[model samples]
Target: MRSIAALFSMLMPGVGQMYNNQFVKGVVFLIIEHYDNVFGSINKAIHLDFNGAHAEALKAVDYQHLLFYPGFYAFCVWDAWFHARAGADKTKTAIIFLVGGFLGEFAAIFSTHLPIPSLTCGLVMVIPMLAGMFIFRKQ
Candidate 1:
C-alpha cells in the first residue's frame, strides 16, 4: 500500500499520496503545481508566438538547444527515486510535498496568470517533503 503511494509519486509526483487517501495534500499539489506549470508555459507559448499557428506548429520547445515539454515526467521520476529510499511514512510525506508543490505553483499562477502551474508544481512540490525528511531523520 505504501509502495503504491511511492509509485504514484514516481508517476505523477503527488498522485500516489492522494490515491493513498491523502486528499488535502493531493489537492494542494494539483492546484499549486500542475495547473500553474502547464498553464504558465502554454500562456508563454501563446505570447511567444505572433500567430496561433506559430505557437501551435512549434511542437518542440527549444531554449538554448534544450527542448522539453512541461509536465510531470521529471517529478514523477523524482517521486519514485526519493520514495524508493523513503521510510514507512513515504505515502504521508508524498502527500504533504504534493500539497506544498501545489501551493507554490498556485501562488505563481495567481500572481502572473502565466500558466506555469504544471512546471512550477513539480519544482515546488519537493518542498513539502520536509515533513518526510523530518520523519526519516528521526530514525
Candidate 2:
C-alpha cells in the first residue's frame, strides 16, 4: 500500500510512490538517485586512483553510498515514515505528492545544476508536503 511507498520514499526519496500505486513516480526517483550514486562512485574511484591506492581505490566510496544517498535519502525516508504514520487521507496525499512530488524532485534535481542558491523548487515541494500533513492531520 501507499504506506509502504512512504517508507521507501523515506529512504530512496520516491519509494512512497510505489506504495501509493504510482510506480512511474517511484521509478523516476529511483533512477535519479541511482545515477547520482553511480557517478559519485566513479568520482571516488578516479580520486583514489590518483592517490596511489589503485587496487582498493574504488573502495573509497563508503558502503553507505551503495544503498542510499546518505543524508538526503535518510531525510526523505523519515519524512515518508512520518507521513505514513500520520496520514488521514491516503488518496489525497497520494495525489498531491504524485504530482507535486515531481516539482520537488525535479527542482532538487535542477537545483544541482544551479550555480547560485534558490528555494523556489524546495518551496514547491514544501507546500505540498505541508498540505499533505494538514489534509491528513486528523479532523
TM-score of each: 0.33, 0.36
Clashing pairs in 2: 2-19, 5-16, 6-16, 10-76, 10-77, 11-77
Candidate 1: what lDDT? 0.46
Candidate 2: worst-modelled 10 consecutive residues by lDDT: 111-120
Show where candidate 1 strays beyond 4 Å.
Answer: 42-139
Q: What is the lDDT of candidate 2?
A: 0.52
What is the overall TM-score of model 1 with all chains considered together? 0.33
Instruction: Pick the lDDT winner.
Output: 2
For each candidate in turn, give its C-alpha RMSD to the true structure in angstroms: 10.5, 10.2
Best by TM-score: 2
lDDT of each: 0.46, 0.52
**Cα deviation of 27, candidate 2, in Å:** 2.3
Model 2 residue runs over 4 Å out of place are: 1-3, 6-13, 22-24, 42-59, 62-68, 85-139
lDDT of 1 by residue, 1-139 (tens): 4445655664554576576666776666666555654644544544444343443423422321111222243344335434444354555445554565456545434423434433444356444554444554432
Instruction: Please write out the lDDT profile of model 2 over residues 81-114, one tens digit for every residue.
Output: 4545543555544555554566655644454353
Quote the positional error of residue 20 for candidate 1 in Å.
2.3
